[model samples]
Target: MDFNLGTCFYILANYKGYRMSVEECEIELRDYDGEFLRRDVKTEGSIQPEHEVRENCKGCKRKIKLMDEGCVFGCCRVCCSGITKKISSFIGGKVRCCDVHNDRIIKKPTKSVKKPIKKEYVKRICIYKSLSQIIYTGHGADELLAGYGRHRTAYLKGGYKEVTKVLKNEVGRLWERNLGRDDRCISSGGKEARFIFLEDGFVEFIQSLDVTFIADFELGQGVGDKRILRRYAEELGLKECGNLVKRAMQFGSRIGKVVGGEKGDEEFEKSEKFKPPTTDPTKYDKDYRFDITLPDWLPYLQTHGYCVISSAVSSQNTNLALKSLITSLKLLHGNDVDTWDIPEHGLISETLGQSSGAWLIRGSSIVKSAFERIWEEKDLIVSMDCVIIWLSWLNNSNFKPRSEGLHLDQNPFNKLDMISVQGMIPLIDVTEEIGGLQIIPGSHVGVLKEEFKDMHGDMRGKGDWCQAKEEYVEGRGGEARLVECKAGDLILWDSRTVHGGKVGSLGGRREGVEDGEIARASVTVAMVPRAWASEEVLEERKEGFRIGATFNHSPHETGTSTGTVKGKLYEDYIPIELTAEQRELL
Candidate 1:
């Protein structure tokens, strides 16, 4: 027996003491000239040429009738003769005709019938009953040879270091992931399943060899993975099998068609058990409304470069905002916060930043009032940005600050007079242990003064914003301050401030945290005076709103649309309606 499993090809060439037997079966076919034909022959042997086989048969005395060009009769002949032969031999079996019309043999066709087929299982059962008790399968070869797409992704991501790690993990967990299930299925036919690749001695020898010798990821796809095994197969004169592109067993055997196709997989995905519990928006008190009163923190904001206004947004509004965000997360990502690969500042759902629900707090009167008071202007446009849901406890074990460190959102070289005020409303209380914003106090003062002009150019033109050098910040005698605040508090900062998020540690759960027990959850809400935005920018913002696109924290700047509305997950979203004030922001 021979089998090609994904990247590896296996052959059991010679078993000295075993003798294979052939069985005779009746088969029906049609000649190339459309004549009905029937023959009884050994199923295992190849058929001789039609002319040669016809020469051995005696001519029949009964009048023979020709069949319709494309109709099949017997299932055995259709299955044994292969697809090409089955197509030519449409009508199968010996025909019993009482009447012939216009020199054509016509029989009423039977009703079309369909039945679920498990050919592999039936074939195995038949083999075990008549041939042998042991069956060879190419099962464990893929796990050992890095034959999956994930292996290629891992190799591309971190080279051999990541790929080898993935392989070792797969090999270690093979028993539960594959071997156990495969053994149960294969052994149900009362036959032993042999995995030569997974044999202890062979696996040990493979493990001892350099990973590069086993799999060369750089060669790309089929030729790259299972390098040594492919070489062995080629040396054994199995070039076609060795060079065959890797394909999953289900696909290669066409078993996926019988198992219900992609719809089945979609149903399975929709049936996930871990449904995130929804937050009750009705339970929270809605005492907040729009206000535009200037606070005493204005002078503090000027000197310190950032200010935290306590209770700037009402607790009820914050809860409602949190509910909306959590619901969106559940719909889009299953709310699987633990598995998210936290970006540079622990931002997730950034692509969904411009969703109408994200602005539940940002669009509220109280939040809008704060922004208007800061800018001292009644006409203010809100920045379409995302919420930050940081689950710091998950990454505390291996936390490391990004090498780029503190950066400025605004380019100092762009314009000294242009000031963009960025703000965030913490949906829950942020403590030092729970982690929040980390900023170098008063960095904006020197930045506005152009004192650090020689430090670096504004990198925004190059696709990234300017970042302050560590020595540059330290030289200014500025210290990084971790600003802690309560739920519904508004934290605002000048765009020139050197800032970044500090990853938090595990601590006692705080009150009013309804977002999956998240350590830190905040909505980035910024507002600039409406006078600053050009008509071109306003039109782009309108287009963004129409398509549910996300944007950065500068209302005056042109925003890039995230194109999330076109995604499958977005199909579950209930469209958001904007208030008059919210429309003004867009």
Candidate 2:
């Protein structure tokens, strides 16, 4: 309390014949232990009456408690403290529900702002996304792969017959059992829910398995939850992951851990703000975005089934690839889109399809590294049937693609296992505004390969090459995003990924040229590991290089030659001074 000016003055005035100055008398009055000081120091009078302490809740203080613990310590069971009440009971306290509180913490539907797109160094984020985005839940895995403890129990008692019965029951009820809850949890993070294990191909693979191979008495006891999955994991060098037993997510993430089982009221008193249970890792916030770089390319490709690397090849090399195409087509100028006309018999189409060796000149260390990382080896072979230059906006007519939207490279004629990946390096920017290759994100894993495997036997001699399922096409209808990139950016995709050339609009036509204006140009080179190709194929490729002939463009098409092709010589067009790793690819 501040000293009153008038009181200080009066005390100074009372300081008569003593040699004390006015300031000194004021100081004495301030230090004096008089009635006011004694009143300020009195602790006895400050304590509230005992009756007042028993009147209200310790938290909100509106309700009355007649000596009952919950009524006094915890607030009225309504809006403010129910989360705390739920937490308390979860930890082992006998939660007595009133009209307002429930026995279990009810999941309240909460609305939030749209979550932003997450970008990260692909591998680092893959683990996080694997858990958080489209989870590969162990729901169906348990039944299909014999992953449950109970499955082991049933097997030990009744053998494979019992095991298959259990599996059939679980598999049949998969949609009813997990979809609703999983959707709720996954949607909380602003991600659409999808499960890899429940896809039809994986389900069929499990169903087709002989019970003996899946669960044998000789193979040693118990329902092997995820037995097949664990074996695959072990084969992939994830022995620890293979051995790790399954636990419910609620327990694994500590969401079900009780707070005050033996600690008593002191534990309850410690929680002040009522922190909610969360599964997201503390190391990174939900909104954190990762700046992608060169090192992230391979992991991104593997995880997402696609990635774009900017400046993967020099502009000169990219331009040379375009130049080779121009020379092969017998066009007047590389710069003039008007001159890039197709012949009446579609000779240009033939040239565009088989200009494979021409694109080998564009290969650089960066491109080679990306390929090596993809196939996981240096021994690689350029796809003989790619190198197409899409004059998407040509002749001022909106190009309508003949094939129905997105398609996979794997047709019915080829086995599902014979998949090839391709890379498209644009000489110009392929933007969404100006149409280009449209790819479905994550289709390589979720849809493509699985669909291929599912279509295997039925599609063989049907003569209908496109094996795309109706559900897949419809489900991912709006998800086919344009593979946008700048000049020299390389867009890579798995062969099985759902992708196709997007027909460009007349709006993409150049301002100056009212007719035949092409806005984008790209050079796509199909690549597979050299190890995958036979000696005959390699010999044919080498012979093509020696004789200056173009090989067949696609596996579906046969090879044809325009007698003595005119262009830059084969050696000049292809890389001559190659590194040992580069030579391995050639």
Candidate 3:
């Protein structure tokens, strides 16, 4: 290995007092960083010399893994991952326990604890040792030798080139893959890590090795198939860890097994049981749904024509919309089930279409940001259209049995270009029971669009019904993914996307929702650029605003011009003032 002056200085400084031989220095310097002493800790158990035992997991009595997992730790994978808990009653109690035990306690609820609980919330300062200080040698040896399973597989399949690619990726993404998680996990215990593997000279030396000698698992003139460092271990007579296959610390310690270990194919299939038929643009695994927090949104949207922005709108806005909608519903129906019926076609004209509270959805910053991203401009107009409050009981009665609203929102003959994008913002959590929006991904592309163009004139007649034919949707190589949105989550889809409101609840009953309860609750908004707005369209918007009318979602096609028809306006029009942004939207 070619050591520059800086590296040589590091080696000399570290080994100076020991008066070590060059061979000894090489072996020692390979794993030693300035943070660690030239020694190993012999202490065991969860806590060490400097570290204090803050608390043990109530489930297994082991030190907690994630800091966020509260004192009453639920040991199940669901609880560990911060998803919904299986038990209902143990939710608010201070008793910390694993999910398995918690479920057991809840199931056998006959034994209620009547004793007054005494608990102390202590504020203690604890200094935990870093993983780097505790496990430096293992991390260093893994980097130097082909210890990772991926390294072995890559070497076996594509030889040196692929192995080198893997190494580069590992090093580059070390922070994202390992260091970041480790840092957070360790820091939760009030500790910091120092990586000897990240030492400049050591990393350079590891990278400069002959790729074949390092990774190729064949008996060679260079070294044996696996663990080149094993040869050195033999030389040093330290055989314990020399030939050991790599295992993650969590797995080796059986922490992962205690909870559910990494999900297998069976588990993956179980989780994706509800994944709809959709064209896979990224070719991601069937189990891979686009995580809302990840930055890979733009590409995903471009490919899928729909993307969910999780936790986009505030709960405050959601609550406001929900209250307004319920209040308006009370005013219109007054607890009368008979009056809550829609037309036989399952279409309700002007259903919660003109409430002043509908402005909450249109003015949402999160919704506006999403619209800007879609249109690539802030100067966009919001459509004063369908902010539906779909009561499953009402719509389900007259609707044709087994009929799904799988249709594109955009009229084909009207305009070739995409003139609008629609946003669906739910006021309440959209459980599978509260059947909501669903879509066929990437069906908006190429031949599907061409096929849809042929039916434009028929589709736009009257109220403009555009349902996806079974031959087109089912026969086509795409799946209809039932979109489940949480309250405050913003869902955006292209106008050409084949989407519709699901008929029945997607699955189980929603929590706290009783039989025949209000099912789907959502508000829809259409966004079009201000530049697309015409004089007639503006005038129509003004008139619609005045009379609390359910204005058209898109600019209405009248002859060769876009304008609102006078007959569509409500009789009792109460004119409302429009904000600057709302005016531009007209």
Q: Which candidate is the best by lDDT?
A: 1
Question: How far in Å is the alpha carbon of 322 misplaced in model 1?
Answer: 1.2
Error of 2 at 382 (Å): 1.4
Q: What's model 1's lDDT at 180?
A: 74
**Candidate 3, 487-536: lDDT as tens digits:** 87777777777777665544334566543445556777767666677777
TM-scores, one per candidate:
0.44, 0.41, 0.46
lDDT of 2 by residue, 322-385 (tens): 6666665553345565565443212233334345324443345455555655666655676444
List, residue by residue over 482-585, the lDDT tens digit for candidate 1: 67777777788887777777655554347554433466678888898989899999888777666666677777775532211122224334447887657777
Regions of candidate 3 where Cα sits further than 4 Å from its true position: 1-279, 282-295, 344-348, 392-404, 450-465, 505-509, 555-570, 573-586
Question: What are the lDDT figures for the candidates, one per model?
Answer: 0.56, 0.48, 0.51
Which segments of candidate 1 are over 4 A away from where they belong? 1-295, 335-344, 349-351, 392-404, 447-451, 457-464, 473-478, 505-508, 511-516, 560-574
Q: Give the top-scoring candidate (TM-score).
A: 3
- Please give the ranking of all candidate structures by TM-score, highest first, separated by commas: 3, 1, 2
- By TM-score, the better pick of 1 and 3 is 3
Model 3 reaches what TM-score against the true structure?
0.46
Indicate the worst ten consecutive residues by lDDT in candidate 3: 118-127
Q: Which structure is stronger by lDDT: 1 or 3?
A: 1
Q: In model 1, how large is the Cα lDDT of residue 201?
A: 96
Which candidate, 2 or 3, would have the higher TM-score against the true structure?
3
Candidate scoring better on lDDT of 2 and 3: 3
